[model samples]
Target: MATQPVTTRIVLASRPTGKPVAANFRLEQETVRDIGEGEVLLQILYLSLDPYMRGRMDDAKSYAKSVEIDGVMEGGTVARVVGSRNAAFKPGDIVLSHSGWQSYAISDGSALRKLDPDAAPITTALGILGMTGFTAYAGLRNIGKPKAGETLVVAAASGAVGSAVGQIARIFGARVVGIAGGAEKCDYASREFGFDAVIDHRSSDFASRLEAACPNGIDVYFENVGGHVWNAVFPLLNDFARVPVCGLIAHYNEEPSISEGHNQLPTVMRGILRRSLTIRGFIQREFVDQRPDFYREAAQWIAEGRLKYREDIVDGLENAPEAFMGLLEGKNFGKLIVRIAQ
Candidate 1:
């Protein structure tokens, strides 16, 4: 007799009205059904928690569909195949799939990518060597177009995406300036990541400090956190500057009442016109064709000691909701991943 398998998962209990709370998520468990043809049962090992997931939580329409109520919160995972009906996959095969916030899932082998633990850490498939790194590579290379001797500014310097963007820009011989929220993050961005300069965005003199840091003006501004960071960088954009609009995390949880007061779109337009700036917004998937190149180059950079990465792992599936809440509050450091199972 085949033994039944059970899986633990988290679902979106309710759409958050503001910053998400613990009540917004619910923990549940279900027995895994027998795998049918071309199906593989994945036992998730790691779950990635990204800032962008916050945008997906909203009920309003956006780039992706909202996670329906009672639906498993969507996310990427690194998992091991424990049961397989697919000819291409075997038991114990480590693979990458969109398993969301679950301890186990059934994948039909439609869009599964096999991962080799020998080449890089399996966790890299969830972060640096995966979506987070690719996001930095595709966005900066295609849009930012940074050049040697130019200055590049990135908000949230210690984060997964921002950190990658700055490090890659340095490889291009660009002066990298990172803006982080506190003294510790600023230190990490400078000492560990090799950023040319670090600015504490929480300081009262943040704008002037940023100006001093970029004496040549900013040739590329990676726009991850909008709002005040945008305001500070707007005037310092060198002529024909490129701004890659990535995650606008600063306004992610903005209350409409307070958010409605920002009438700076006109000012932003005026700056764009006067400076002839080249602003481009990009989603990581748009550069899917370049994934191979991304993998090769990024891996080489890591091997050559030009690239580095960090992870903040939280243990257990039940804690994903609390950790995710902390992610939005900027309580997490480095690439946030939940260790669901061994």
Candidate 2:
């Protein structure tokens, strides 16, 4: 009998209380089972680290189940099939699979989508050409309903999702204003993603700056970071404005705080009533019907130079924990992905 292959992987060591620390995750080696009928053996190449993963780390009830203790951490991965018992895939075939934070996985071919290296870089499967991009497309088209000449605002503007949101809104003939931390990200959002204006949310005068940037007020606001950024966009929301609530990264790791005027709930409700705002919260899977359309159009935009995507790649799977900690602090410049294999 031959020895089974060993795969290196990371798993949840403990549920985090506040911000996650390295102690929350454990790196270990496990045996890879021999290929079973209809299964493919994959070597993970890239693993996406997203803000929503933070929520999954907790044992709280959410749209998705929490990662069990000592279980593999959940995420999307781009991988290459190393061995296969399925006719749909072959050795050396690349694929997009949700194999989580691991070096290898045995997939049953049901949840795997083959990727063509010729189409675009494989890393894009974990980012721009995949779920994040679909998130931006679906949120804007379905819930936001951007209109020509309307001012559309997006927080976390330099991210994979937010950048796409800004560009797509602009393509819809809407004026786009982006809010991001620091001057560098603001410049990139304005210059690279075609945002009409960009505001630095880190500034002491962030609210005032946001007000100044959106002279016509915000007609469509993409809410991804729901702390002070939402506070600034609140009062500036135009009558009948549409808001699509995406992942609130800012509040993901911390408990929601109560502040001035009993915090933002009263203000949010007031704006909703006074302006007749339409605020809809969504999980990307709800709009999976539009995936084919998003892929066709987003690819066209990428090829035509109308859309720009960026990635911040961390070199090793061993570094995923550190990189993820930085992600919570807004240290990553673009889509954060961990390179687990060559």
Please tell me which predicted candidate would have the highest TM-score against the true structure: 1
lDDT per residue, candidate 2, 67-115, as tens digits? 9999999999999989888999998999999999999999999999989
lDDT of 1 by residue, 166-270 (tens): 999999889999999999999998999999999998999999999999999999999989978888999999999999988888778776764677588898899
The whole-model C-alpha lDDT of candidate 1 against the native structure comes to 0.92
| TM-score per candidate, chains pooled | 0.98, 0.97
Candidate 1: residue 273 Cα off by (Å): 0.9
296: Cα error in model 1, Å: 0.3
TM-score of structure candidate 1: 0.98
Best by lDDT: 1
Clashing pairs in 2: none
* Candidate 2 whole-model C-alpha lDDT, 0 to 1: 0.91
